[model samples]
Target chain A: MQKRISIFIFLLVHIASINAQEAKMASIKEGSFVPLYGASSKKPTVVKSFFLDVYPVTNEDFLNFIKKNPSYSKSKIKGIFADKSYLAYWKNNFDFGSANPKSPVTSVSWFAAKKYCECQGKRLPTMEEWEYAAMADEKRIDARTKTEFNTYILSWYEKSKTYENTIGSTFKNYWGVYDLHGLVWEWTSDFNSIFLSGESRKDKNNDKNLFCGSASVNATDLMDYAAFMRYAFRGSLKANYSTRNLGFRCASTTKY
Target chain B: MKKITLAILIILSMQSCKDNTQNKNVTKEKPISDLSIYNLPSQWTNQDGKNIELKSLKGNVLVMVMIYTSCKAACPRLVADMRSIESKLKPETKKNIKLILVSIDPETDTPQRLKSFAIENKMNQEPWIFLRSTEENTREFAAVLAVNYKKITPIDFSHSNIISVFNPEGELIYQQEGLGVNNDETVNKINQEAEKIR
Candidate 1:
């Protein structure tokens, strides 16, 4: 009888642990915004979620990938492969002897970034996910304030340095993700499609190719004035164009 | 014997519990198509100085790239690269594709400026239009595309370089970054993805 009672208690405890595990697994939703940077009072645009890295695949990561899969080496890549700008600075200028293996990679094309993410059982985040993460902390205001929001954002650019380092070296956002705002511009998995005239944001169902969107604000405010400048920057790029600042990180579905 | 049987039963139940937890983990991945972009405010304009409503470009693939006419270095190269992809397509396939260039430089890229810029670039392709929205709408669009840009100076802007592509049904198909250098790969990927729609 005592053994039977002990068995019943053991079964209950095991079931409870399983229930807890299931709950943890079920939490990641499609628009799950993990807050990286906290909100600033002036520019209330809260960045709730973002990629953990600033740049794309680097030479170090790609070299290891090539070592594992020799078919993807430079010789094997056909027409319009990595250009001189892809790894120009890193290979020729920087000394990476002390770089970390798991740091965000640099000097890779969009194809190479996608391929590297795939090989690692991961994929690039969608544009929607990326923007959602960026503006997670962004807020729209009727008027602009003389505050640290714009100052801090502008300061990020001034302090911007080379691509030789990994993410998380600077201050991290609320979600524990690193290097979203200041590092290098990461790549997403969307195509370079623009929105048409008479397009309704609600009916975005028709134009599936449109990957870019932004927050709403009045044009009168000085701070809100150049919002369109942000959108056009991404639309102007071709796929293979890699610059000193362009880099990417990978995201997995949690299951993989 | 009875004691042994009870212990075995407890162990079996625990094993089954572990399997259930694993199953829950497997279901967390949602399909990409299930996601949608957030809506924009009313009263927007296209790059060609045309009023924009959401209903006009139904049942067409919308490819959007953001740029300013004043951009000397990356912007022109991006347009040329996109043109290369557009030129390669069959006319009929091209008809189904809507190429849009949204200007981030709203201060300078007025409706007239956008219109002239489109003509200068030979962007007369059907359903291809350039647009300039209010600074608010532009930001909304940027947030949706995940593209980031900030003005370093009056004429110069520091921004993320990327292109966004959507399918005929308005589902985000793929995005390619790196403009002039990645043109061939970008075009190939877009063509391959567009072919899979039907």
Candidate 2:
């Protein structure tokens, strides 16, 4: 009888773990919208229906990742993949220090975030797809026109130490995804594609000397100040750069 | 018997999960510095239809630019800039440098296409290499170089015209930006890095 009980317990634990290993992903339906900048000025970039992580990749999740791939750990990571501050907030190479393990992992470079997604059979969201999903509020799909939506994002910009909060702490949006705002700035796969030079002089006029095809890419909505800030921030980022407030989540083409 | 089967099944699944993150591609080598581009593991096919890793050019100063074969604008000027930089270098210094043109449109710029472009442009010689890789790897490479590019149409891509110079250690030493721009400074930087190779 004890032998049978032990077998049952093992089976139960195994099944439970299998379920836990599978991260939850929210299904975002196919949609089309004109981004502030995209493939073109007039044509709306069409985003296919895909599964996005319901929450940002957490410290607990990243710890598990480093356990499997030690090369990505703080000490072991290559300088080509990240800068000196990669995981600087962590107490040690393996420990998250005073950080909440349930909180989204920050101070991760685009390369590190990208590898994390790829290891899980997923990929980082493109800027178009990320903006498409993030434009939503609690009810509407395209919420940039909503005054409150813009205000909420702008207010979060003013808030400090928001990265300390755990994933899913913020209000879930229309697609049931949380922490797109009021948590941390996330890395997109093609963050380097932005043309707006971060230097005040270059930002004043779209400098032709700095960009090869700057004229081809333009802002469809100059009024979206919140998104403009996001674009400018992305424009300034190099893939190897890691910072305290920046984090990322994974997205998959296939539904899980 | 069922108990044994269950245990084996559990072990197999766990093993596969571990397999996902195993260092399958990395091989034993002299410990690469964190800042070296040699740490990148992407593969490429050269103009000669040869599969090569970036590490193969490890000890040579790399002067690299991105271009597409079909491009009518900027690429010619960029190629001219590379050639001019090459001409300005002392023959001794030139021998230690590899002028590489990486194709942004890998689909159209196959090894054969690159070879023809090399021959037509009179660069099909020693110290001049043309390479193309998978679209994903190319994008990652561009990100490392901080070169912004986007496919504007089916045939055209708008890419930054920046020539990056890497030392024999695969560490970026200098960058010359803009098309048809004076490359005197860039040439001097390249010579300075190449001089260290001896």
Candidate 3:
């Protein structure tokens, strides 16, 4: 009878261990805002109502994800799906070493992050959605004009390796989301959809050769240096490329 | 035993479904390389409204470029560049190759629309293929190719113009960026890859 009881407990524990982590989501109301960079004719782009994870996907959540989808594990991921440094901080295929499990998972490729979101029946937030939600501070939804909000984001930029910190350690924003700043940079669904001027300048004498209609996409707010940095950083990345300070969270269109 | 049977049933069903859709000569199955575009499982529709997997195009060297049909600026030049590349390759080399134009604006560039565009551009030929897929797949493909594109207005998009070359094995071997740039190197790469096919 004792053995039977122990077996039942064992089954329960095993099932619990394998279950995927379901992060809490914040409902963002649809709104319009002119972004610092990307797809602009100096007009505000409308972001429809959607749901976003309160925090970036944590190391613990990712660990659970890989366990369920073994093909996406550190050693097993295909070269086309990720670069050499995918999950480079991890000790092995399964172990994350001494890193806190609650810390936001960094060094993850866009493909891996996209797959994680898909498995959860979600997706990586669009560039516009991410920028819109990220603009919020504790008090105001659109805090891009605020000096303190800019300082806080820029300060986090100067601080090296804040990805080591646990999720939700930063202050919650107006939209009830955390770690939009003061944490690792994130992967968005449309990260590849940015055609910035830096690359256009590199196009070198042949303006229209590199991009179609490059003249139209000028930044509406050039003073928002912090947001500009984000756009520039996103432009530099390829899908398979992974970095130590980059991670991602999933978003869904449905509020549920 | 029942589980194994069920899994086999699923696999069989998937295979049969695939076979019905793709009606080309995929003679022998080869192990897809990890770096191959065939590794992507996204389904695509051709100008003829036929469904295809990227793997089905294996054993033929591919020269691919992305363009939206409605674009007034770069696409025409991009198409001209593709045609020039095709023209440069020997007729024998062209037999072993497919020049693919994938649409970035899938909603605007339907199979019927793609067909009209193909006819309009005089690319409605044997070697020229026009393809479109779901928005997600199109985005994923663009990500793989490192082609940055965003919708500016309801009708306009800002997009990078790059022509990609893939070997017969579906691995991207080379890329020639920019519109109306020299295609000499791009042509050479295609001819070299196509040589190994037959």
Off by over 4 Å in 3: A1-20, A200-207, B1-28
Best by lDDT: 3
Error of 1 at A13 (Å): 35
The TM-score, computed over Cα atoms with residue i paired to residue i, of candidate 1 is 0.39
lDDT of 3 by residue, A1-256 (tens): 6765675576566445534356799999999998877645677788999999999998888987787677777788878889999999899988999998999999999988998887676889999999999999998989999999999999999999899998999999999999999989999999988777655325653646688887887888888999999998998899999999999999999964
RMSD (Å) per prediction: 16.6, 4.7, 5.0
Candidate 2: list runs displaced more than 4 Å: A1-20, A198-206, B1-29
Task: Report the first chain's TM-score for all candidates.
Answer: 0.57, 0.89, 0.90
Q: Give one digit per residue, the lDDT tens place, for model 1 in A93-204.
A: 2333455544555656665566666665556665545555444223421112435544554566556454556655544443344565566667766523333222323323
Candidate 3's displacement at residue A42, Å, is 1.4
For B1-198, candidate 1 gives per-residue lDDT tens digits of 576687777666545112111233325444212223312223568765679754355456677877888977567777776777687765545666777788888999898888788778777657578877776456546645656554434675544456788765455667766554445665665666566655
Runs of candidate 1 exceeding 4 Å displacement: A1-59, A90-103, A136-149, A194-230, B1-198
Give the Å error, residue B71, model 2: 2.4
Give the TM-score of candidate 2 (chain A).
0.89
Instruction: Provide backbone clash counts, one per model.
Output: 92, 0, 0
How much does candidate 3 score in TM-score?
Answer: 0.90
* lDDT for each residue of candidate 2 in A1-43, tens digit (9 for 90 to 100): 7877787788778666545656789999999998887566568
- Best first by DockQ, ranked: 3, 2, 1
RMSD of 1: 16.6
Q: Rank the candidates by TM-score, best first.
A: 3, 2, 1
Better model by DockQ: candidate 1 vs candidate 3? 3
